[model samples]
Target: MADQLYLSLWFPNFRFEALPAALVSVLRQFALVSGEKRVTAASVYPISFTESPVYQRIYVNDDRAQSTEDSIIENAVAEATEQLHDDMAYEFEMKWNLWMPEGNDTPISEAALDTLWRPHPSTVKILGFGPHFDQATYEQNGHIRVDFGLDTPWVMDEEQEEVLDEEAQKHVQQNVEMLLAFTLSVEKNCGISSRLLWTESGEPLAEKLIARLQRLN
Candidate 1:
């Protein structure tokens, strides 16, 4: 149902401290290439959006490929670990439907929004939308919090949706959990993870995610 690309890397003599910084630096490269507004690297489930790697499959389509951030990530890994000559980079496998929604709660509507707008999943046009934002979020000792504005991530007020009604707040909370779940799933296989809390002041999850986030192609 879904396609999964698994990459396992072994870097010799790589210190744990250096590994974390290496991942963070490479992630920063991702934000720059994808123009993603925000990301959290400290979560148990890490996720980011650029474009559909499938579009670049070349085995079938290419014209519809908006961009190939997925490939960029792959190449980034090679370059990232290049300094560590002792490390060996090998393994490139793709399985279908790896990121299927299945029983998750991100909602098709919000996902669709991310599909169309937000981070411009099909192209790099998102840069024209506005400045990008990055963040660091963590769950330590069962306590969760986030530091937004990688560059300057503050609450976005498209209109005045700052004070969300109770129902709206609940919806936001749900999607936040859904995002966490989805990101975590990818991280489980990719050796990366992220958890970023998004609180919709008064807007719907679909509106906020689609308008603000960049979905996986």
Candidate 2:
């Protein structure tokens, strides 16, 4: 089974007023690592996830001129965090490419496996949490939480009976390297004091990746 993956980052002596700059740093790091320069969207949720956003902006569109300013990491963070408060959670969405199987329903033979792998764009959410938001979820989820949607690009379908071949293994390894590179870049460039990569099911991603690699071996 594939699970939702998240990277949580904590900063030492962090203050709510510093969130905008921190968010810009994190988003800029992501752009540097993933090569996706624009932030597609941003939203500010008040109090908790249940409440409607107090502020929202979408930069993705056909018109390049309109989104030019707002799509930039610094400007997007500034606009979203303009009304910053302890109970507001600011979220930004960006794209990252990952290797994925083209078709899963139809199983491919060894000879055709290589043709089915390609780089697919995936949505990555970078969220900055205020201290009082969601009853202080930041205490456990960290001041900044990166929601990487699904772990499929890393582990694929673990439940599938089909064993990965050399081509499949190669693609999987590429995805893993991309994930590692992004995480390492965020840790180094974002001035993070601590970080955690975890899954929705409470299972360690490293253990699962090790198991998958062993199978591939």
Candidate 3:
């Protein structure tokens, strides 16, 4: 797996003015720890990796979670709107950096993957394996598309097959399923218009996100 998987969210109908308060309300519900200085605020949430506190992260294990959070973001958008048909969007992102050691293919169990990945029954609708690419400069091309639900086995790849057995593959599949479910959950909750897009880059995140948003529009 790569060193990190980046997930970005944007509202196709929200403006920049909807932030701070909107973000604060949504973060509070998820029990995030935030630090604000003047106009800048940083929020942190602790997420479990393999049942241990490897590093900070977050997750949603239920479907209603999306609806609940969506309401908060939507309300913020409504308040920030000046007209009846304002078409601004909120652009945000989340990244999952590999906290655990890379070369440790300890063959996770299927049951465990199920618990970690599948947060809801409807999440089972995910497909495995996204479109393959061989370009060396793909990550920096800036043409990346966010295709979470359509991809099958989104987590595992050929490298995993080289290390894991059939059983392990199955477990990884579940993990991918859970990833899909979780992605959907965030999309619903955060009220994002586009799917989660990923890439590896040395450029600023804000610049990358703005470019992607232009493409979507």
Kindly report which residue stretches of model 1 are placed more than 4 angstroms away from their true locations once superposed.
1-71, 85-163, 186-217
Estimate the Cα RMSD of every predicted model relative to the unseen true structure.
15.3, 3.2, 15.3
lDDT of 2 at 193: 98
Over 12-71, each residue of candidate 1 has an lDDT whose tens digit, in order, gives 343433543444343443354334423211111112123222111221114555654434
> lDDT of candidate 2?
0.82
In model 1, the number of clashes is: 19
Instruction: Estimate the TM-score of every prediction.
Output: 0.25, 0.87, 0.35
Candidate 2 C-alpha error for residue 129, in Å: 0.6
Q: Which stretches of candidate 3 lie above 4 Å from their native place?
A: 20-154, 201-217
Give per-residue lDDT, candidate 3, residue 177. Answer: 38
Which scores greater on TM-score, model 1 or model 3? 3
Error of 2 at 165 (Å): 2.6
For 46-65, candidate 3 gives per-residue lDDT tens digits of 12112332122123324634
Top of the candidates by lDDT: 2
Error of 2 at 131 (Å): 0.7
Give the lowest summed-lDDT range of ten residues in model 3: 122-131
Query: Which RMSD does model 1 reach against the true structure?
Result: 15.3
